[model samples]
Target: MDSRVANDDVSYSSEAAISRWKFAVSRQYQHLLDKSTPHVLHRWIGCFAVACIYVLRVYTVQGFYIVSYGLGIYILNLLIGFLSPQVDPEIHDGPGLPTRGSDEFRPFVRRLPEFKFWYSITKAFCIAFVMTFFSAFDVPVFWPVLLFYWVVLFTLTMRRQISHMIKYRYVPFSFGKQRYNGKRASAESTSLPVD
Candidate 1:
């Protein structure tokens, strides 16, 4: 004899209504991304604008407090993401680092995808911009000292990241560069016959 019957109250589906809703939302987001991608240059410009505002505010106030520290932390975080390989060699099949010809067939995938990376940077800048409006964020201290420390921190962090890139045989800007095959198919036709 049949034990179960199909009914709304007696349903045993693995995916609930909430799950379907979430899936629909995700698909909509993916569709939006497919239509167009964000320009990184524009995002960087936004970040620069935010930084300029922060700098101008600090210059007028003559001191930086918690906002400066927050900015430093955010910059360090972004740098770490920028320098590190998105695809970890340990997890993925590779010879510790991406090399030419060793795994040419394998597509280079990043651990930290570009969309999220830029999103975080933009978010940080916006937060800093908002913090500028509040008086409590201002700390009574020599603004020059904070600027000096930021410069020093940036230099050291960048130096270490550059060395890591050199050692690992990877370039973060590989995605940005135009890939050239070093061949000209029309070269032979373009040359006039010597005779």
Candidate 2:
């Protein structure tokens, strides 16, 4: 009975140690993510490198076309979400993109935020890269057909998204655009008139 109790205690302590180690590792992972948040350009460059590596792997293997197709589709979905408004005007008539110059100027809010968009794309590529290593994911198909279809689909989707943007008069991007700071009061306007 004493030996049984001792074994149980040892097992419990080992489990507790494992739990603590996992917690510490997760906390460190989260910390790194937080630290990387502000370096948007760097993060994107890293993601681009990963994508390039994945593409190289697929091209060298000459297989996993299906996985590549799936990744492309997933990326298209992410792009749509990134370009879309949070509250779609077609669905709800609430505060949406201003149709006229007289209307209040509200910044465009995306359905999927930039950070989430980047993270999802990066993660998807990583998953597809991993899938490329396995034989089960390497289904054979005519690569040109898939490529052509993807191009057609992408063109149609972009046309629709552009039309939507034009119809709503909202540009999703803000870089190199004019900014209006409220008019500052002139010194003459504030000065008291001397008799």
Leading candidate by lDDT = 2
lDDT of each residue in 47-89, candidate 1, tens digit only: 6787787778766876556687777778687768866777654
Compose the digit string of candidate 2's lDDT tens values, residues 83-147.
99898888886888777778997888999988899999999999999999899998989999999
- Give the candidate number with the greatest TM-score: 2
Evaluate all candidate structures by whole-model CA lDDT and list the values in order.
Answer: 0.69, 0.91
Q: Could you estimate the TM-score for every candidate? A: 0.61, 0.87
Query: Model 1 off-target regions past 4 Å?
Result: 1-36, 89-93, 100-108, 175-195
Residue pairs that clash (backbone atoms under 3 angstroms), model 1: 86-110, 86-111, 87-111
